[model samples]
Target chain A: MIAKLRQVMLVLAVAGLAVAAYLTYVHYAGVHPACTAGQSCIKVQTSQWSRLAGVPVALIGLLGYAAIMGSLFAPEGEESRLATLGLTLVGFGFSAYLTFRELFSIHAICEWCVSSAVIMTLLLACALARYLLAGGPAPESHSSRYSTGSSGRMSA
Target chain B: MASRTQQKAQARAQRVAEERAQAQRARRQSRLRILAGVVALAATVVAVAVAISAGSASSAPKTTSVAAKHVSATVNRLLGGIPESGNTLGSPHAKVTLTEFGDLKCPICRAFALGPEATLISKDVRAGKVKIVYRSLCTATCGGPQPGAFSTQQAAAMAAGLQGRAWYYIELFYHLQGDENTSYVNPGFLDGLARLVGGLHYGKWLHDRSSPQLAAAVSSDQRSAHALGFSGTPSVLVQGPRGARTIPYLGNYQTYESAIKAVEG
Candidate 1:
């Protein structure tokens, strides 16, 4: 089960990275996707809220995906599993906040953002399951516990 | 020999334990890889969706330029017998007057010209339902000759007005505007425009443009605009028949449909 869970996390991390990369590309290129039906794209893109702080929102998304991918390579143990779970949770929370902003505040939905939000939600669930289902940690190595039995036999 | 056998058994057990741990690690790694792949796939799908939607959304609106029609013969006939010197576009009996203080070169004024001003002209001015006056405020920066620049442009416009084509000339200038403050008011450009409007007595008009009376009239209009608190072109004032109420310049009516409806009512 732990193995399966790891695979799910790995997949989500890579997927997130790809989404972030594309969004970053669009942000810097200033080439909006052709919008015919709704003229709101330019309005929304040009709005002050399109950038958070100084960085483009799309670039932020790319960095987030990269962080998630990096978390996946940590050594397998109770600590690593917990760390992964925490990171996924954070990703999910941030994605939700951005989604809310898009829906209510910005009033324009970036489809790529929505998809990332969905994937992040799934990733969070998978990470939590791994943490709960996997027994806490691998048994500790038995190096210091006992000397050779051959030395003890002569005394007996 | 018994000891050796026992040692061999322990060694085998240790090897099995190592194999189990290795298998577990490998399994975990594989699972993580699979999860990563799934996420990457989903992200790709999202990116594609965004690209597709954006592509369709921006390709719809098309703006075209149409040659403006000449004023109706009826309008020309209405202006023909009226005295050319004073405000005469609307009813003399009208108590409340609405005047449009505008610059021929201002873009916002140009938009107003294309928008509610057009509606107001058709419904109120042409129908004599409301008295309307146009006060041309050709200030230096707005549309007048800059201090250092050759101002043949304003001269040409004033000349056109002398030929009784002021409104036509203004509209043409707005329609064919170049970059602002770029010295676009050259003689050749003015000549071309005058020719387009037909029969502009350029020499006579140019001579009339700088007349002291015309300059005074322009100044008076500018003062009136300032008194009314209009610092911009395309400012309009609508007053009731009794001159009891006045509405100052508001912005585009696109988002204020209700206000427009009430005003029209």
Candidate 2:
């Protein structure tokens, strides 16, 4: 189940990465995305919120999705799972915030942005479930850290 | 076995069990600590994200609402006595129509507005030989890169056109134009132009600027400019006896007139 979950997350991260990478490329290329709400896509993508500290948010998103993919592929263990959890939670949270901006503040939607956000949200859920089902940490490592040497060797 | 030895063995076994239990408790506490730390980190990330967006939301300074205190007397004399209606600034029956595709922030457009445009308005425009139509080209300096305050300024001017004071607003904007790449184009600038131009209803212009109609109008003008294949601001398309065609530089009064006449001929 954990392997299946990781595969699901890996697939999702790639989808999100492709979307984000496309957005970032277009942003620099000065090509407007095909929009739904008239010029809303143009308006939102070109808005000030699109960049932070001179870095395109799309680039940030690209890196984020890539990080999630990396963490998912890392050798499964307590550290790896914890890192994935941290990164995806941040991704999910930031995605939610950006979606709010797109709908309310920007008053327009970018299909790419929305798709990435959805991917992030789903990835977060999958990650959380996988982490819980995997049950805390790798027992070998956890037990070693708290080993008192005199306890029953068969902890069960 | 001796009774003392049996008691000692039992005591040792009990001690080991207690040690294991204590270790279990410590592990649980450590897990909770890590969980708490992760939660705290997530909270910090969220707070930072919101702050960055909020800061951008208010990146522009508090809008100044100063009305224009210095209306150009010369601008008035030049535009005065001209037939103005809608976005057109000349006699309705003129044989030639000179369409200006411009960004208010474009220096070239400003030059044309302060130079050739003024001449055309005073000369052929007043004489009923030519009419000028002010169309926005946000595709250029104004809309280029990003649709910042310059785009909004264009929209505001278009909205003012709805009230038939577009010409007034256009001329005043050129006269008061600032650095093309700065925050000079803001609500205060709009307010100032409305006041300087004197006949436009400030409230209506403000309301109309962000309206759907203005968005459509601005987009239409820009799209038309794009369709025409003109790449920059202050581009002219002359329509006359020769039909409508984009023309080259209207360098001076003579060049400007010839560009129009050449199209008319």
Candidate 3:
């Protein structure tokens, strides 16, 4: 479970990082993301909410995904588990907030934003699962981090 | 006695399994507690990041480029170079004549002027693909209680065309257009626009604007538009070898370019 979960985290981190990176480049390049007519993609990207304190929201997302990816690469320990959990939680929460703003306040949806949000949510789930099953594998099952079937209390 | 000993061994194994299950539950609970604490702390930090970024992100940027709808450096670079005769743009002898029946104050027409028309003139028209002729439908079925100033604005643009700056004046007007039927197109505004066009004889434009011929020219354009059975302002007549046909309004500028392309063929 531990090994498989780390692979899952890595896959999610890379995917989220890709989307955020693309958006960040687009924001800096000042290019529209091929929004069709009557679509709110353009409106959302060009909205005031697109930027944060003179920095494009895309850049912020990129940095966040980068941090998550970095944490995933670190050694599996209490500290690393905590780091991954914290970063993924923050990303997930912020992504949810941005999604809400786009659907409500902006009244439009950027496909890129939606993609990023989905990736963040998935990463959060994976990170949380890893953090919960953080302990080393049982002596009985050397390949698995978690015990299967019936479990008994540890004496110590 | 053997059966009793076997029962005792079974009880010991069951007790060990129960203990292990309880310990696993405890570990799961402890992990959740730690996870909750981490989430809470991270949530606070994330909230602060959002709050700090709120200053720039809250209010939408007012000066958005409006979808590249305005004049670009490319457009400016190509201005005043095209040949103009009366209200026509591009080579006078160009094979295709793209006539736009537009009122200066019509908002839809304004969109055309700002978007597709801007691109068409700069790109297609400049390349001698089509000659765009701007006709003023100053009256007749425009349906609004257009102030007399509307006609004056049209005539003023016509008068500027006499100085070979007709397209220049029209471009400038759309660039600085005011709200419809607002009586905003006064003599002073037109004069300022002419001055802004640069190298256009503003004094001569003022003098020529009063000419009965220029005023009559505007009336003639309106009569021509009405004679064509045009249903409204902001209509187009594309005249090419395929024959002249009305370019049906699609309420967009992109279609305008396609219409021109179809006509040129």
Which candidate number maximizes DockQ?
3
> Candidate 3, residue A35: CA error in Å?
3.5
Candidate 1, superposed: residue stretches over 4 Å from native: A1-156, B1-88, B91-96, B138-158, B198-200, B244-265
State the lDDT of candidate 3 residue by residue for B1-265, as single tens digits.
Answer: 4488657755775786687777878877787788789988988987986787555444322212442234423335657578878788998777788899877765546546756677778787888878989888753214444457666888888888888778777776665554442455666667776766556777788899889887787788878887888755567887887667686342344565566666665
- Write one digit per residue (lDDT tens) for candidate 2, span B1-265: 5489657756876786587678767876776687667767987997798798777555432222232343445567777788788788888999999998888866557656766677778888999999999888763344433456655787777777788778888877876665333455667767767766656787888788888767677778888888888766677988998877675332455666767877775
A1-156, model 1: which lDDT tens digit per residue?
A: 888889988998888888778767655544343445242343244333445543666676677667766767877876677667656665676576557656654456766677788988888898878876774345555422223444475478
Candidate 1 Cα deviation (angstroms), residue A11? 24
- B135-163 in candidate 1: lDDT tens per residue? 75544244333532323344455556666
- For model 1 chain B, the run of ten residues with the poorest summed lDDT: B60-69
What is the fnat score of candidate 1?
Answer: 0.00
Top-lDDT candidate index: 2
Interface RMSD, candidates in the order listed: 12.7, 10.6, 8.1
TM-score, candidate 2, chain B alone: 0.69
Native-to-model Cα distance after best TM-score fit, residue B70 in candidate 3, in Å: 24
Each prediction's number of clashing residue pairs: 29, 0, 9
